[model samples]
Target: MESGNSIHQKPVFWQESMPELRPCHNRTVTAQRTYGGISAAERRAGRRAALLDAALEIIGTQGVDKLTVAGLCAQAGLNERYYYEQFTGRDAVLTALFDGIAEELASAIVQALQEVAGGSAADTPSAARENAANPSARRMRPETRTMAHAAVAAGIHVLTDDPRKAQVALAVSASTPELRSRTLQTIASFANLVAARGIDFYALSTPTPDPAIGFRATYLVGGLVQTLTSWLQGDIDMTREQLIDETTDVFVLLGEDLAQRLR
Candidate 1:
């Protein structure tokens, strides 16, 4: 292994024979080559991210229709040429932005559910025993409430923490045909994820073979999306805490009813 001092020392080939004669020229060359150095791919990806962020701001503040290439490039502080290098057009940027938010929301909800379930398994032994003794008591367990609260809070935070993400994911996507189609596909993907989680949570038989389970997942996803969209759009008037509490209650009640019906 090389010593730290040796590791940082200039290579033998990098040393100049007549150091005093070309010091300024060598320094200028090195500075030009390494200053703000980044790989081409990294630069491209960075530009793309900046453009996406600018798109979100424009879509969130103005409407989606107002998102022009010139405006987006200006907001991103990148040239129009750089915009074309990443996205084909404004619609592509919109699609990418919507997909990114949808992905984040789904991941947040899944992580929240996993954490809650793990905690419940660790800390709810007494409640679990009581639930085992009384089937009706399962839905009333402290663990159940904890899981509901965590899931709702996670989902809502993905929206509320960034208004731009909320507007792009919920509002802007619905305004155009292409974006709407992409949003619907994203919703179906999330619904499948929820359905899979439900099967595991309920310890249901594999090869589910039941259409109702799928339908129930779709219903839950659609209802939650509509509720969130309404809340973000100001159609629903409630504080963040109120929304979280009410949504958590609704989810817990829905889960209980669904669990009963599934049996």
Candidate 2:
């Protein structure tokens, strides 16, 4: 047997200037390689999207209880490792899916509002003329009515056009205790968005920080979500357009009333 000191000796190859013995950059290159024109990051993103889609299918159909890591991986057509790569666990997947749907709805509504606002500047005179002719019909300012309709229609389409998204956002999100808490927090965030938009549109004397403004905003957004969930569940029977119209009316009425009270 070799002595302990002999075992510590460097091998002859260590004396040679062996570039191959140095830390290899092959891993870095391989990691970034666009295999079949898709980089590793792109592949990861694709897997993440697939997982989210799978979560939507599972949660929307089987309920959140059925959304296990194994079930998610199976639905995504991905390995368990891929699921772990994108999400810490089942709750993370649900949260991400819900948040994505919420963001999509919020973006659609904001865009619709912005489009109406932009056109209002050009169309104000005609709208004003119409309001003058039907003064009794103009409880809600023409611009406010237009904005309300645009925002409501956009939000309804986003939720209903893809029923799965609504199911995930409304039903499944409230299925589990953890998810219910998350949903409440999301309601608060959406309420803040509503308050900010109301401030900009109604030019309310009460600032967004005012409790009354906060209360109305929360009431509007939270009530809308509850009503939408009921409608989606058949508890409320109405056509898509009718739903949009009725929701728009509530938004305008309560909004104007709250603005007046604040003033």
Which has the greatest TM-score? 2
1-263: candidate 1 lDDT, tens digit per residue: 01000111222211112212235744633222222788544566677778888888898888787799999999999999887777776666766776667666666887888866765542666445535654444556566656666667887898888777787776645667876777777678777776676677666655643687788777877888898888877899998867776766666666666777767
What are the per-residue Cα lDDT tens digits for candidate 2 across 1-263?
Answer: 00000111221211211122333655422224579989666677777878888888887788778889889889989999887666766666767777777767677888988877777532666456545554432776777767777788898898798787887776645567987887887778878777888877777644234687788888988888889888988999898877877777788887888787766
Model 2 vs. true fold: TM: 0.79
Worst 10 residues of 1 by lDDT: 1-10
Clashing pairs in 2: none
Error of 1 at 18 (Å): 42
lDDT score at residue 191, model 1, on the 0-100 scale: 72
For candidate 2, the lDDT comes to 0.72
